[model samples]
Target chain A: MSLLEKISDQATTLTPGERRLVENVIDSPTSAALGTAGELARAAGVHEATASRLAKKLGFVSYAAFRDALRDEFIATRETATRFEKTIAESTSDTILGELAREETQALGRIEEFITPEQISEAAQILMRARRIFVYGYGNAEVLALLMVKRFRRFGKDTHQLGTDPRGLAEQMLGLDSDDAVLSFAFRRPPRGYAALMETAKEVGARTVMIAGKSGALLTPRPDRLLAAPRSGDQDAFQTLTVPMTICNAIVIAAGLTAKEESLKKLDRLGQLIERFE
Target chain B: MSLLEKISDQATTLTPGERRLVENVIDSPTSAALGTAGELARAAGVHEATASRLAKKLGFVSYAAFRDALRDEFIATRETATRFEKTIAESTSDTILGELAREETQALGRIEEFITPEQISEAAQILMRARRIFVYGYGNAEVLALLMVKRFRRFGKDTHQLGTDPRGLAEQMLGLDSDDAVLSFAFRRPPRGYAALMETAKEVGARTVMIAGKSGALLTPRPDRLLAAPRSGDQDAFQTLTVPMTICNAIVIAAGLTAKEESLKKLDRLGQLIERFE
Candidate 1:
């Protein structure tokens, strides 16, 4: 079995700290494979001893042995280019569109299995109650950040997109307080400022909700709410934004429903403004 | 019958110019209803007389009479608040996630019916051949534009996101030529600088591809290639990014496949750079 499956099989037997370390391993095996046991514990907000204990619990002789197995697994599964080659070999030019549509449809169908309604409701509640909202997405995820800003602003929430530059991000985070909330989108590898952003939010006592791909489960000092799912294919394939975008849609809809009268009023006001200006 | 149904039924009988007007009406019935017949004709890149003939061919006495009917239809269906009410009434907090998933899945399933493989190949070809790519997405669409830029850049294409400011947009447009391509996303209502962007592309002889929601059908002078589809539910309902995002995925994948060797090399280089810097 893979290291993740082994951890899952032993879930009920783990101590709270060991569970956190297991989460770090499952969420980002790539990092777990590359980093030391100490780094893994730090990321999972647990003691280093927990990592070694978890290693023994999972049938490894030592933490080093467990990480060696993880590194082997990561190397076996992290061939992204091979995944693409397989996809191309399986699909011709004529069939690629239909194939991709099927894949996306399947991904959308499985969203409910991985993400629960309670998670959506709780995240929406956070968004609704926040005094101000900051959204963070880097690389391709920046699009999702922009989208969250547009939708929340439509409902009359004061929302801003967090920048990637260290100085700019610091400035944005400085304005954040206990009343604010941060919604971040992280896929595959975490963005450059992810750790700092999460740490700062924790320090200020601001709420955080993360919508992440499978690897996001490893995020250090996990957010108050984390919604993570795989995007259609295995980790090595070219991932699309369908699953995360659906989660965003659900949160936005749920949040709107939670604050219906006010949201509708704000939407109507937006309509009027658009009519007058455009 | 609804005016759109009537037009669809007699689609084969429309002359080339009249067909353009029909496309305008079907694509943006709101614009057709809110604007004058001359405006519709101008938007469709057809003569004003073609609008009148299209109205008559669909059995209306004049374009004004046809537009009046469209206005009534728009009013009857454009109750955005009512749509939200209906959605909320049908779904409780417990079922919103599942409900939205079903809605999005249905939208993704119908994508192949609306967008053809030939279209995907053609758009991908344009991206591969273009000297540089400029992606234009305003408001919510800005996210999609950012995504396109990120994906195309990974494949080693020279790409840029077109800004929305008047002066900045003008300066951006000044740099375009016949060797460039502009990919735009428009939904519901066109953005303020949309007309100028399309016109400038035409004037400077750049290839243009538009991925639009239903209302984008009425874009003035139309794009060189247009891919349009509805976001499940009626026009007034809350729309998700599932459809357009899927289309974007298909195009990016197709483009990557067409230039497999070069794209793979660049992606490998990107992987190396990330490992070194990240």
Candidate 2:
């Protein structure tokens, strides 16, 4: 596997500082591979020693070996170019939809090679056991947060979403405790106050899970659990949300499947209520 | 191509009534084929003659031939079960994420066979020219609506989201004219007001577009244009949003590509404002 791919494959096992290094490398592989160990460490807000340790963990003899691996991988992939770019060049309206679909499908497939299934199951378990779950998605991501709230609520879980209210968000985050879990979707151009909300969760010792794209590297202090779903498509073209949404679907489904008995009982009760009331 | 594939391949060219017939056939091909022409027509809320016309349109001599073709295709696919069910049965935390990714990727690929690029480009053009674009999302689809609002607004389009506002929604729809366009994301178990909202849009002569799943058959009076992104994965497993989100991405990209100069200018202005202010 390539260095970045190897880092992602082991993302769940890495420490926060280590994951930051992985995120940094992913954000700009060319620069990350060419830069000195100190330069890379500073960029990721980690010590040089931590950076070296990360490199070794990924099976590199030294940081230089890791950089070499990244360079080799980058060159190999660049020679072929992304499939989406080729699709755009050749596609007519008649053929573009299929190309778009196939590209997205390939994105989901690529994410599979990097993100571990254990990470998904672990995140689901955290959500299931929490006393209450607070979901937030700013700007466009807010809808995703609402979806999470809807899914968890269907199973009789106490879930709440912080809508378009920054003040309300601050209040909500302040109230979370260790028994609570905060699940937030922080995608590209993440809304203001993301850091504050995450900080509050940390202060109260709440479990934090972030569903984010590659720009997740900018999240200064990362969440306790990170489910990275890399966004695909040309930067100038369009940003696809398939990866993150798919992750959301999988996490919800895994939770439901793991808690099948309880979920079914709650669903039955909900059905009765709907029938009686509606 | 098979009958179903033929319908999808010509998605952009089909009429509203003919499109409804295609949707009905796709929703449950087994029933669409086994039932008489009149039965299929009734289910699609169209006349029996329309169903016959649809079959002929797909190059079949009679509706019976279309049914035979559907049965043949269905049987050929049934020998192999869904990859998701197999994944669920054998999954360890180590393997589940990859399985989820692959399944969702396949979902996108499946949608490609149905949704056409012309449909995407057309949706983009509608949003671009509208005096005002009113976006709505029912239940889980609300996120898609919000996403549309964010994307269009970034490109400096006049857009508004009918956010959880039944009273406001009713009032807003009252103001629409032929120059206006209403786009709604209505998926499974749509909200109560979906019909009312669509009705109001029609009464005002506003162009209407719907981004929906196959169950769009449940829609009372279909919109002027329909962009269908089929739901993927097993019925009992978690529902994936990859297909719809991918469609959204493609539409926005097509819109940006079509109106290149204006979008870039707006983005540039926005960048300057952000740099100077916050």
Candidate 3:
């Protein structure tokens, strides 16, 4: 914890008077309390000159040091808030409907943070023209790849998943030529051989895109494009890729939107077929 | 919950007047409000106007706004000082330590926000020398075929993964070729495929690296090096890779460190035995 957080905890546990003193100056500047201990004491409902005394109790030699603690707290709190807010901008947790209003607000923030006409146009163009397009990944990405495959099939692209296989995978790659495009979803660590494939895909003239982490440029040697998630490696665990995944899905949808009228009609038909079959 | 965290939450239940109002403000902007108008009013010891009165709620709106309704209470409470204190330092919940005194103080404050030099080097080195890498990705990375396989083992490198046939996943990928590397694991929506192969080891690979999610990257990429983890995806009733599954475990720890010496020593021993036995 930063000094501010420490002070906050210590302040709250102390006697009301001392706690009051701790609270007021916790976010204050060191200079604020030095000569004005009397003023701060009055403001906090403590002895007129208690600020310095409280500082001493808290282990600071003078009110100036306490003020410094407060300033540090303020800054740390600010930084944390900004980072947390950034994560929330993209975060999509389950069953947060009760927060619809806030959710909408946050959504807007996210949209503004990233959406650009160039991005929409480019992503859309890629989706529209991708030949032999494949959304390759494992885990959650498997489901996403399936969805993309289904979505793109309506546009008349021949897409297939790289199911669990070793030799078969090699054989499959041998069939592809430069005209094909693959959207490989290896965000964080980029899988064992993921980066190697991007290198090969490019060698084979296949267009590849990466949606990944805030680490070494391990994966994308030949990536035609890269989308760095708003949330980096830091907040990954406490939070899942709920935020970035949603953003990527939206990109797919946006790309679909730009794929033109016939594509939408085709999608409807495809959905109808799949629905009927189910 | 860590001791630090429990106390952070308890800070909110405090009476407004009873708290070091300034310190609470610095700690959490929305905290002073209890999310209920009456509760907020009661907590702050003020009328609605007085609560609305402190509109500079610094980080929040009026006290009325902060507690009007719970949108994502989880969001509000999730990232606290303790959580940030660790993750920013790259110290996450994967380990069990939560000691406040022993905590890495500068880790959070000085977090790289991006990847660290050490992490990059470690991941890169892992990928450079894999003899044969077999990646097993069930749900999300089903399409990761060829992506990981073709990437690492490019130019005839022996990188492999589960074949499309789920049944052959174990035996096929485990047939280590020339100091093989096993990169098999599951991701969001864990598949039975990975769980089945968890115990197998590639005779060819020198070492193993396992990457799992917050929940075991849904079951660690078995046999070795672990990367970031546990990104479960739920888009509909189905959350597809909320985080990129394949990429999450894509850490090439071999980028910097070389367990090659030990691996080579074992490989040499195994090769001689295989030659003599065969």
lDDT for each candidate structure = 0.73, 0.67, 0.43
Best by lDDT: 1
lDDT of 3 by residue, B177-237 (tens): 5555555444433557554454455334355544433333223333444443223222112
Where does candidate 2 chain B have its weakest 10-residue lDDT segment?
B75-84
Candidate 2 docking DockQ: 0.13
What lDDT score is found at residue B187 in candidate 1?
A: 85
| Prediction RMSDs, each to the true structure | 26.2, 23.8, 20.0
Listed in order, the DockQ scores are 0.13, 0.13, 0.04
Candidate 3: misplaced stretches above 4 Å? A1-151, A154-248, A254-278, B1-77, B80-130, B143-157, B167-171, B177-179, B202-214, B217-250, B257-278
Pairs clashing within candidate 1: none
Candidate 2's error at B9, in angstroms?
A: 31
lDDT of 3 at A89: 18
What is the per-residue lDDT of model 2 for residues B147-253, given as tens digits with 9 covering 90 to 100?
A: 88888887778899886678877887777898999888766655668878878888888888888775443355667767764566553334556678777866776
Give the Cα-based TM-score of candidate 3 against the true structure: 0.34
Please tell me the TM-score of chain A for candidate 3: 0.50
